[model samples]
Target: MEIWPAIDLRHGKPVRLRQGDYNQKTVFGDDPVEFAKRWQAAGAKRLHLVDLDAAKGDDPTANREAVARIVAETGLPCQMGGGVRDEAAIESLLGLGLNRLVVGSAALKQPDWFASMCDAYPKQLAAGIDARDGMVATDGWLETSSTPAIELAQDLRGRTENIAAIIYTDIARDGMMSGPNFEGLAQMAAATDIPLVASGGVTTYDDVRKLVQMQMPAAIVGRSIYDGVMQLEEVIEIAGDK
Candidate 1:
């Protein structure tokens, strides 16, 4: 399993949102690139980035050139989502040497588009399935679609060519430091053959240990690492390798 240190950006600044609520925001830093470096220094091999502005469909975006520069300069394999809607966005990000692109709404709305993306960029596109109460959530957690997350993920599993991984985010516990939904994660892992990246909650090393023990492969941990509730070394140790 790979421990992906998260750097969620809002207006180009590192920010963490409570329960995916923009209003309940906590600004963690002014420089996201510096923050990425710190995570790398602390032994982060992979990074998870979210553009909060993009997630809300706001005009002001956080996934900027500066962030692409972080990838170019740091050379850490980074996966990012939020605001990446079209092939152009994916192209732009890929041009920056990004490791992978996490597409949520697009993948759910148009499976063919995802197929086309995979055909165009094999092993580069990742599907993000964020859920609340088991139902799939889209448009930055403001809208709950009729589809359940497990069902949505199972659909992703069938798409073999294009998808590199599936990032699963639980809405209720995100940024609350409660813990990740291990049961939900295990179910999704069972439902799909696609590599899964667990996200949200993730409050302690034991939480990571649980995921690792389950053999889920990868995960995205944010608040815990940022709030001193967990460490990169601890995550790395338990994550094992690959």
Candidate 2:
């Protein structure tokens, strides 16, 4: 299993929001690139980045630049999502050297377009399924949909060849540093044949261990590492990252 350290960028700064609430965010530092480098040095094999501003329908220019710098400096394979809804946005981010682009709202709202994108960019697109109580949330978790997350994952399973992974995030646990929703993740894993990248509420080595036990291909850890509730190196070691 791979452990990905997360960096949520808001206006070019590294920050994290609790329960996907923008009003409840904690800015970690001014330079997100430095944070990326820190994670890389700490033995992170890949990085998970989110553009908070973009996810909320704001301009992502600043965060885009920050992402570019991180890619140029750290040289770690990075996967980013937030406001990536169109071909142009996808091209722009891929041009920045991102290894994978995650699409959430777009995938839920327009499955055909998402499928076309997957066909166009094989192994470069990941479905970002952010959910609360098994229901899918869109537009950066500000709006919840009636669609069940497991159902969406099952639908996306048809395009598993093109889709790189499914990044399943439990919105309620995100940034809370409590623990990952193992039950929810397990349900998603069972519903889809595509690779599962667990996200949200990953706080301790035990959490990572359980995820590993669940056979998750990857797990994204955010607030816990930033808040020191968990150490990146320890979790990386637990994940057996080489």
lDDT of 1 at 12: 85
Q: Residue 15: error of model 2 in Å? A: 0.3
lDDT of each: 0.85, 0.91
Q: Model 1, poorest ten-residue lDDT window? A: 59-68
lDDT of 1 by residue, 1-242 (tens): 88889998888889999988999999987889998999888888888888788778985344676678789778988888886789888888778788888898888888777878877899998988999999888888888899998887777667655689889999998999999998899898888888888899988878888888898788888988888878877788878843
Q: CA shift at 158, candidate 2, in angstroms?
A: 2.4
Pairs in steric clash, model 1: none
State each model's C-alpha RMSD to the native: 1.4, 0.9
TM-score for candidate 1, please give it: 0.95
The TM-score between candidate 2 and the true structure equals 0.98
Measured by C-alpha RMSD in angstroms, how accurate is candidate 2? 0.9
Top-TM-score structure, candidate number:
2
Scored by Cα lDDT, where does model 2 land? 0.91
After best superposition, candidate 1 residue 110: deviation in angstroms? 1.4
The lowest-lDDT stretch of 10 consecutive residues in candidate 2 is 152-161
Q: Name the runs in model 2 displaced over 4 angstroms.
A: none
